[model samples]
Target chain A: MTQPAIELDGVGKRYWKIQERSLLRSLVRFGPPNKTELWALRDANLLVEPGETIGIVGRNGAGKSTLLRLLAGVSRPTTGTVTTRGRIAPLLSVGVGFHQEMTGRENIYVNGMLLGFGKSRIDTLFDEIVEFADLADFIDTPVKFYSSGMYMRLGFSVAMHVEPDVLLVDEVLAVGDIGFRIRSLDRMREMHRSGTAVVFVSHWLQAVQLLCPRAVCMHRGQIVFDGPTEGALARHHELLTSDADSAEYARGTVRVENRQLLKLDGSPAGTVQQDSAMIYRVELHFDESVESPQVLFQVYAEDGTFVYQMQTPLGESWRTLSAGAIATLDVTFLPRFGGGGTFRNVVVVTSIDTSVTYVRDDGLAYFVEPRIGAAGLSDLEAKIAIDGVDRTESRPMRFGGTWAAVEGA
Target chain B: MNNRSLLISLAQKEFRVRYKRAWLGVIWSIALPIFQSAVMVFIFSRVGRFGSGSSFNYAAFVLAGMVPWLYLSASVASSTTSIVDASDITVKIAFPRAILPLVSPVANLFTLAISVLILFIALPIVGASVGPRFLFVLPAAVLLCAFTATLGLALGALYVYFRDVKFMVQAVLLVWIYITPIVYPPSALKGAAPWLDFNPLTGIVGLFQRAVGAPVPSVRALLVSVATTLVLGVVAIRAHHRHDRLFVDLL
Candidate 1:
């Protein structure tokens, strides 16, 4: 019923790579001077509803940062339009626009104002922000004297309290220690509950999978794929493998002919159920005779976190393979991740001599759909009846989802 | 609070940070320009034999013109370079990019205000008594700030595109004082006297001199300063508003 919080209509941005930035050189460089045009984004169209959480994944030059800059209104789109309702907050890194000489308390007002919050708003939120940052003792101390973690915590706390309609978080969640990271995630989850749209961009696939339900995969300045988070991640891993394989394949002796993910019933599986067995099967063709070879299998979550790893038994010597031989390797595992998410499985083949690696393949990916009312990286499913008394139960959640918001764009 | 409060807050930060770790603190704001004025008063009045036997005290003349001159030069010099200097914030955060340049001039206002206070107090010490005519100092200060902000916003916006403008501003400010008739009255110059009347700051300094009961500048010079400030002010606001959202690209 409500208008989407943010919309980009045919948005495009281009930057010039000037050969010489100086005024004098530019004057002397004559007609059609030395410069190149780089289109950072092209025809980027997106619409985000309120309380939607969207993830952006891309390689280095895929223009994710440029898109954020445009959405934040820090940079204007060269063409097209970016329209958004209400305030847009860019979850900037620590000390952005902060005066280091000012105390944490002072910086909060200044930073909050710079981010477009009223002074009275910051005043009321000040104590809660301090408690959240856990910097009660250092509130009056100059930020320059605060540790980097403390500085980031104070920054994160103030931004978290702002109640933005749309929050653009760019890899700022990995701040502080693990505890702070979790707390920050929890706070973001809270914002999600209260109806804020979050545009999160991160290379950490696991975090992306944990938080965002939908994602857009960007490649070479355009959205190559946009759908469920797992599908986007699967597409991304394929891009990475294909990108990496082209340069490395020329020197390898063994080639991965084909790769497939199969269920326990031996049917090719594109998506699997939670707690079901999955076989990461790779077909390899050898160009040269090889002695006992070891095969390595690794599973990575959509956030690129290594979820599982195993290898063929170290001392179990498989028979030698003559030249022009084909080998089929199967890696079996039970997908323990709950709630549907993408997982990438890599297959590597190497000789026992430890001097040569035949092939390293990471192109295969599969999805696991978690059970109802389940969450987190794994489905522990802790169930017990201790002497006829049971206490394990989940109360009705005020926040309906793991992260309350639904992400798009 | 709105941008008005944000502007004041930002300026307050610039003011506080300048004195943060220094032992001399706000004293430096008063001391540095006073020290410069004292040295100039000695050199031009006694050593160079300028402004001698004049109806006004050369010391008061020098100190009065010196305070505003210092504010103009320092504010312009720093504010021109501010947008580029704070690229870290400019690149990441989204707000009015003009705020970056606007903050420094306002931030330095505290120092300018403090120095002006020191000037009023120093006037009596130099045998220049306070007069009701000194009320003109309020308009003079406003005119001075208008001139500074116009120039600052215009050049700060320019500096984002052409970084070498920073050095150009510094080079100009270094020589601007000598030409503004701070130590000697504008009448002291010969052929350049007519040209000096065209310099916008000439009337500003003249007004500052009048604020402390020194010699009055011609009406033409005062009119020129007002016209120039308004014209440049419009141009600056236009330029900055057009480029405000685009400045981050260059950074």
Candidate 2:
């Protein structure tokens, strides 16, 4: 077996949260600066072979960016070692080190050199970079004149042309237009095929799922789960929901608990098929008396786009509840998401007139499999006919077992 | 690809971007020093009178001093804040952080070269005899840049933690020229001339003055300048090596 392309051996990073950064205060203070230690990452050990892509999923401050910084060699781990076999290109952000006053051509050469490419090498790949960026006309124009998308495209184009052995991507794919995104994705896929090791970090679970087969889920500076992408995402959601639960309990008014997505038979639903009916259920415990509580349901795609929202009828009085009352709320709906992505179900409890919000439950998330050969935001369930002959699958693709199993399919 | 080439390209970019939009372009680089030198020569020649009985031409001596002084002040000021100014790049990319501090000195070499050329051209008009001693300006320029770059590296690293270094540097530069024996000769200080040998820039500015037929700086002053550069160089290099990857954390 060849060597792993990237390796992290028992890595940990400790950051000192300095209370006061003033030089005079630091000088006058006793032993050390007033600081608390924060371990951004702890005991992380990972190895990726050549041609492998791994996604990282985590909530904010969960050590995801810290890990990427280590991988990029931008920061040193306080403990252990991080090793990469060959050239590493960090696409942490597009347009890093790009001078606004410099022409596009000049900026490309400078950015390429900063990434460790020689001027002669940049010259050889200059045409290809500009063409890929689709900025042939603006190559001579100063970057300050280019649109933000154009700047990002040029930066991405230069980075892709480097063809690094190990690529570290952190949410840079979210930039640029759809056409450019697609092209950049294709470029990444090409890099993946050519035996490059990739570590991708993003909040967009759908993009992570599409790009990486394997993933690591981070929580509170620890790797809670490292497995297939589906399992990692599931673990990530579990951590998020649990964190939200503790925060909600601290609010002290109405507490939302036991949020779940359930099947018709009351079993917990892991993955729902397109157009399949599932119920979102939650328990609301009120600390004070409430009048005519209403429920609002919202669905969000994995990328945080609001997919659907519905609420209780306006100006309608259900029933008033006395203090210390516990109420269970359930709403049933079909998962009609196209392109088969993970989605979240959120329920908000409020007054009948919507004047006041009592409690908002941390969302429960589930997966939806698309109709066969269907891709988009909504599953239109369209039929195609050729010469009066209908050509559409009579039954939608069946997604069985838990969401993790769907990764193999 | 290598740090050297990266430094050269970055410096080139820095040099070009400075005057990219300005209508006068690089002439500003040549013009600023000449104008400053002209004003200094006019005022000091009348009021200061430090150079009245001097053997060498006073205009040439002042211009010679201004060449390195302008480069030193400009390079040091910019390079001291270089790392902080490039926080966007430093926080993301991985490179030797020391390079950021060194870039300004290298970039200002263009202006330095122009000032030196103008000094040489004006020497003849100012009645100073140009001789083979003029070649001393080459080593003088090199040593001047080395000293400026090392100081910049050290200050740039410190600036990441204490922002007061920025204002301190500016304040120091304002008062630095008066003490460096630039407008006046060291002999003009009378018995206090020996004390002037302690300033690090005394030796550097002395070389420029020497190029235009001023007396050679004291051995003690040259030793002090070289020693300061060596000590600062060691401190700067070690600081960067230890804090290179860690600088991004603070940034």
Candidate 3:
């Protein structure tokens, strides 16, 4: 059997959370010192074979970003070690290391070298990078003048051209238009097919499902689940819908004393699909007196966009909810709203008609894997036709060819 | 893998991008400092009556001091901010973090070389005889750069964590000009001159003056400066090697 391209054993990182901003003040302070230690990751172990596409799914602050940073070798592991055999290319946040004053062409060289490319290799791949970015004419203009889409496109272009042996992709794919997003993903797939080990960190489960056969889910700096993408995602969904899901947050005025995603018959239903006609009944037990109680539920697409929101009637429903009272609110809809990815629901209990919020239980994520050739978070049953003749119904419409290979041609 | 070549390439990149937008282009590097030296010559000779001695033409004297002082100050300022400014790049890519701070000295070399050449031509016109002794300026310049690199690398690495190192360097630089013997001859300090030898840069400036027929630095002062530079250089390299990859986390 081939050796794993990358290996991590008991890896961890510790951060000193400095309470004071200025360095001078810390020199003399002796009383209860203003500092805290945060273990961003601990005892994490993984072995990835070459060409394996692994997805990392977790809530915010779950150490997903920290794991990517470690793999990129941008920071040393405070404990343990990480070993990798080939060149690493990290597609971090949007416009990572791009100089605003530099033109697109100049930035390519700078970025290329930073990613461990030799000058000769950069020279050979120069035309391909520019062509992939589709900024043929605007290459000479300063990057500051480029739109946010153009900037991200250029950054993604450089990363893809490096032909990295190990690709570390953070959620930077969330930016750019839908078209470019699909193109970049296809490019990543091409790299994966050619034996580039890939680790993708994203909150969107659909993107993970589509790209990664295996995945790992992190919770509070620990790997909660690791296996097939479906199993990891199922555990992730359980973490979202479980009774103990978001109640663990230490901050905030009101705590989700209790939460339940129930079926119409009041039975616990942990799994919900994209096309299921399911009623999402969210019952929140508040710990404090929330005046003019308004429970808000927002659903996000795989790309992290606000696809839709459902809130209890603003002025009319559940006024002045007393402390310790269980406020069971229900949202029944035809689950056809999302396209095909992981959808996260943020259950927020706020003061009606005011910006003041009382309780928020985040990280309630679920998976929605629609049938083949579906688009986006929810299938909105979008029908396109010419003079009443349905295009999709009659024949599979070609939305241009696959974007990666045919891009330059 | 080849650090020297990578450093040279990074340095070239820094120079190209820095002046890419200027209307006068790369010539601005040569023009701005020459203009400043010209102004200093006029002030000291005409208004300040700042001649160190009758035999010494104040123009040549001021040019010697101005060129090196400018090199030191500009390089220091650039080095202090180098890591912080390149935080964007460092946080993403893996390379020698020291390359960021080294960029200042490398780019400033162009302007530094020009000033040295200008001083060479002005020596005879300003009443100083030119000889092979002038060749000492080459080693002196090299020493000055090595010293700056050691100091800048240490400070730039430290500043990533402490953050106050940048401002502290700024404050020290403001007062450092007066103490470095840049604007006056070492003899002008008189009785205090012996103690002032402790300053590392004092010996460097003294070396430049010595090459140009000014007073040779006391043996004690020369030893102190060279020692300080070597010690600082070793400490800086150790610190950088220890903290190179970790610096990006803070950035």
Could you say which candidate leads in lDDT? Answer: 2
Residue-level lDDT of model 1, residues A290-325, one tens digit each, is: 788888788788677887778876546778888789
In candidate 2, how many Å is residue A76 off?
Answer: 0.8
> TM-score of every model?
0.86, 0.93, 0.85
Query: TM-score of chain B only, all predictions?
Result: 0.95, 0.98, 0.93
Off by over 4 Å in 3: A21-23, A241-271, A281-333, A342-365, A376-409, B45-55
TM-score of chain B of 2: 0.98
**TM-score pick, better of 1 and 2:** 2
lDDT per residue, candidate 1, B1-251, as tens digits? Answer: 37778888888888888887899987887788888889999888876666776778778888888878988887887788888888877777777766767787898788788887888788888888888877777888899998888888888888888877888888888888888989887767866798888889989999889988777888889999999989988987888778777888888
Evaluate candidate 1 and give its CAPRI docking class based on DockQ: medium
Task: Report the C-alpha displacement of residue A171, candidate 1, in angstroms.
Answer: 2.6
> What DockQ results do all the predictions give, each relative to the true complex?
0.64, 0.75, 0.51
Share of native interface contacts recovered by each model: 0.71, 0.64, 0.59
Q: Which residue pairs overlap in candidate 1's backbone?
A: A52-A406, A53-A406, A53-A407, A54-A407, A119-B1, A205-A302, A205-A303, A205-A304, A206-A303, A339-A370
Interface RMSD for each predicted structure: 1.4, 1.0, 2.0
Candidate 1, residue A383: lDDT:
64
Please provide, for model 3 over A195-286, each residue's C-alpha lDDT reduced to its tens digit, 9 standing for 90 to 100: 89989888756667667778898888989898877778878877655634543664555665444555566676555665555555555666
Better of 1 and 3 by DockQ: 1
